[model samples]
Target: MARTLKTQVCIIGSGPSGLLLSQLLANAGIDTVVIDRKDRAHIEGRIRAGVLEQGTVTALEEAGAADRLHREGLPHDGFELAFDGDRHRIDLKALTGKTVTVYGQTEMTKDLFDKRHADGQIFFFDASDVSPRDLTTAKPRVAFTHGGESIIVECDYIAGCDGFHGVSRRAIPADVLRTFERVYPFGWLGILVERPPVSHELIYANHARGFALASMRSATRSRYYVQCDLKDDIADWSDDRFWEELATRLGADAAANLQTGPSFEKSIAPLRSFVAEPMRYGALFLAGDAAHIVPPTGAKGLNLAAADIRILSRALIAHYADGNDHHIDTYSETVLRRVWKVERFSWQLSTLMHQFPENSPFEKRMQRAEFDYLSGSETASRALAENYVGLPLD
Candidate 1:
């Protein structure tokens, strides 16, 4: 016989989004159970974007999960952009009066996991055949097999924080769900090394060869990436070749400060921008990658997910706290408004900074023009800074 457990919210993934919402709602006196297909260590081992908008930092603090983040996160008042073999600063703090924090996504996920576990929150990791049912009905629940037994989690609502490939999003009827996507021709070949970063602030560089980004996880640990063909194999990119390409793209001034070392982690991740409309279908409301995916160009993936959860956690809290349905009714519209704007920023940045194979000379000139405009016009720089720091969540 299958065992039945009950909770107010059944989070369909245990990544940062699921863990964060569960943390917030749990603090709001609501009960939740998190379910994920991957085990704890597997999830923690995944390396991801580290840049955090100020709003994301606030959400973590509100959830009581920012203690270590504040201590360890690298705060940057501005980031540099490079083109035409020259580096320029955006002065994010001067223009927008907000800064971003560079704390590894893995570290943030571990923090959420630890905080949630200490609060006696429930989690089912390494579960198989996870499925959501009765989603269109008043009472929804999840079913999955775990530890040689079938288990059902009945809940008042279901939160689909599972990613793009997860099963939660598919629960919506085909006729009701709408999706848009763009698969870039290139991917980011990234490496994690123990050497210090080439720059104190992140640098997004555009060279005739391709695009390169100099980022870091901490004072002593560096993360770097250079654009590469999607078909390129990791074996082809040895330490020497990878560093050489990175240096060439970064130009002499910035590359002079770069410290080369053997990378412990290296991988190539293809770029894609995707979104699913009407984030809610029945009792299943999608958040994070389940509803949308932005290219890593602007480092918006994790921050966007946190935005969805912040809006979502507020709506869920209102539903249980005061029997209010206003926020719940308009959640998708509210979330998507900001979603498209952020998507635009990521897409625009990707277009302006990356060397597209099919781009014409006219397109290349237009890209250079935009870079030059930002270099001279404070207005243009402020616009970029505004989007980078993140727009207000409505």
Candidate 2:
């Protein structure tokens, strides 16, 4: 026999987007239930993107998740872009009046998970799956199983925060969906080293060979990535080989203070961008990667997801409190305005940094020339700064 429950909102996935949205709704006295297919330990242990834009920090602080982040994270003024043995620094404060903070997604997830766990307010059903049903009807449902028993949840509204591989996006009818996509020829091979960072600030390197990024998750944990052919084999990249490649691409003339440690985590992230219009269909609304995915080149994946939830949380609240569907009806249109901008920015960053296959000599020259222009031109650097620190949330 299946059990049934009720809430004002049903959120699938306990990621940053879902958990944060749940927190916001719960703060407003709205009942929300969040569920994820992964267990608490599994979710917290995964190594993902680490950079947090200034706007993301602000949002997290407002939502009370910044307590742990502030204590452990470092604030970075800007990043160094190196090409052909020449380096040019873009000062984020001078260019955009904002700076990005270095904080890993794992830490953020742990903070949000622990905060909710402490309050005992937001219900996160980890190691669970919630399925959507009857979206076109007045009463929608999320069915799942927990502890060997099936459970069904009824909600007035459903938030599809589950991400690209989630059920929420699939629940939306195909006829009502409009999608835009861009796939890249390369992927990022990343590793989390146990040693300290090689540099004080993050470094983005564009060598004739490929692109590399030097980043940090904590004072003791450094993160790094190098562009690779989409089909490169992880089997071919042993620990020694990985460090050698990284040093070659990112190592500078000056001693980089770099050290190699056993990489606790290693993985490849395929580059792609996607968005689905009208983020809502009937009582269901989409937020975060469930609706869009940006290439990791710009570090916008997690931050954009957070921004989507921030906007959707307000819309969901208005619908329940005042019965005003204005925001809900226009949700997709509203978010896409910012979404397309990020898409462009991510694409630009990817092209400027990565060495695409099948490029002609002229195209290669154009890429290097673009790099030169960005290095020397105030407008280009400022544009990168604004997008990197993040655009406005409202």
Candidate 3:
């Protein structure tokens, strides 16, 4: 016979988004169980986004998950844009009256994981062959394997934070779900080096050859990325070649002070904008990457995930505690309103920063004109500030 468990909420995956959602639901006095396939070590080892917008930080703090991030994270008032060999700075604090913090996703995940693990609010490393069914019925259940035996968990609600490749997205019925996506011709080849960053603020460099960004994870560990063909081989670019290309695109001003160490990790991420409608299809709710995704150029992935769960947590509380489904019923529409706006903003940022060999002269001129307006015009800068900092979440 299989073991049976029951909870008010069941959350899948243990990334920053899943773990944070779990903590918030737990703090709300809901009986929640979080399950992940990977162990603690592997979950914390993966490197991801490092920038957190002001609204996201505030959301985490309100939910009691921002203590460590507030303490250890480095706050930046602005970042820079390098174009035509000149650097232009966008002062986020001055323009928006808020600051964006630099704290790697790993650190945030580890903090939330540790807290949940200690309190025994999460049941991880016991997930395998998980599947959810009959979400429209009164009784919703997730079946999986644990300790070589079948396990079944029944919950009043389910949170699918399983990310882009996870099984949650596939479970949605094709006819009912509508998906919109735009795949880019190029992708980003990212690397993390064991040396101090050359600049104090992030530099978004737009060179004739390609696009490059100089960002940091810590005082000693720096993160960098360059645009590359969709199918470029990681092995083809040797260490020397990597440095040479990076220097060519982002090293004009700091030729002498720039020093790079051995690369600890490398990855290639394709740029795309994706959205799946009706985040809730009855008892099961989609959150984070399971719901929508934007290009990383705008640094909106994690922040958007955090925002999604804020709405989710509130709706769940209202439904279970007060028997009010008003918020729950409107969850999908409310979140997607912001989703489309972000999709537009992210697409604009990507088009402005990247070099498209296929673009016509008129298109190129329009991009340059838009960049110039954003760099010099105060009204234009404030509009950028509003989107970059984030829109208000109800």
Candidate 4:
């Protein structure tokens, strides 16, 4: 017989979104069980985006998961936009009175896992054949195999924080699901090195060759990326070649200061914008990469996930506290409003900073014109700054 357990909420996937939602709900006296297909080591080993919006920081603080983040995360007031061999700075803090924290997603996930583990929150890693049933009914249950034994979790609600490729989103009926997507022509070839970053603040460069970004995980660890053909082989990009290309794209001053090192981690990530409408289908609500994906140019992927957690956590708390369903009823609509805004911003940034192969002379001139305008106009810079630091969560 399958062992049975009960919880107020069943969280699927152990990524940052799933862990964060579990943390918030657990803090509110709601019981949660998290299940993921990967082991803890593999889950925390994945390197991801590091920029965190202030709102995300707030959410982490509320969940009691920000203590380490606060201690180690770097705060940035502005970032540089480089084009035509010149750099234009967007003062995020001055423009929006908010700053972003540069803390790797891996670190944040580790923090969440530690907090959850300490609280004795149940987790089933290496879970197999996980399925959500009766989502339309009040008593939804998730069944999966763990430790060579079948187990079932009965819950009042289910939170599908599993990613885009996960099973949660697929569980929603195709007829009810609507998706919007735009896949870019190129991908980002990123490298993580044991060296200091060229710039103190992040730099997004639009070069004649392509787009390049200078980012860091800490004072001693640097992460850099250069745009490349989607089909480009990772083996073709050795340490010297990547650093040489990166320095060329960043121009003279930054290039002169650039430090080269062997990459400990190197991977190429495709760029795309995707969103599934009505993030909720009955009791199975989607969150994070399971529902949407934004190009990394705007650094909105993880921030968007944190936003979804805030909305879902509040809605679940209301449902459990006083049996109020208003928040739950309107969760999808509320979250999507912010999601779309973020999508637009990501699209705009990607277009602005990346080179397109199909661009005509006229198109090239238009791109330059926009860059010049942004460089000259404080208002335009401020607008970008506001979006970069993240717009207020509604």
Q: Candidate 2: misplaced stretches above 4 Å?
A: 122-129
Question: What tens digits encode model 4's per-residue C-alpha lDDT throughout 134-168?
Answer: 98987899999999999999998889988988999
**Residues 73-170, model 1: lDDT tens digits:** 99999999999587779999999999999999999999999999899989999999999999988879999999989999999999999899999889
Better model by lDDT: candidate 1 vs candidate 3: 1
lDDT of each: 0.95, 0.84, 0.84, 0.93
TM for every model, in the order presented, reads: 0.99, 0.95, 0.96, 0.99
User: Which sequence of candidate numbers ranks them by TM-score, best first?
Assistant: 1, 4, 3, 2
lDDT of 1 at 370: 92
Among these predicted structures, which one has the highest TM-score?
1
Q: Please give the clash total of every predicted structure, in order.
A: 0, 0, 0, 0
Question: Candidate 3: TM-score?
Answer: 0.96
Error of 2 at 101 (Å): 0.7
Reference-based lDDT, residue 13, model 1: 95
Steric clash pairs (candidate 4): none
State each model's C-alpha RMSD to the native. Answer: 0.6, 1.7, 1.5, 0.9
- How far is 245's C-alpha from truth in model 4 (Å)? 0.4
Candidate 1 segments exceeding 4 Å error = none
User: How far off is residue 273 in model 3, in Å?
Assistant: 1.0
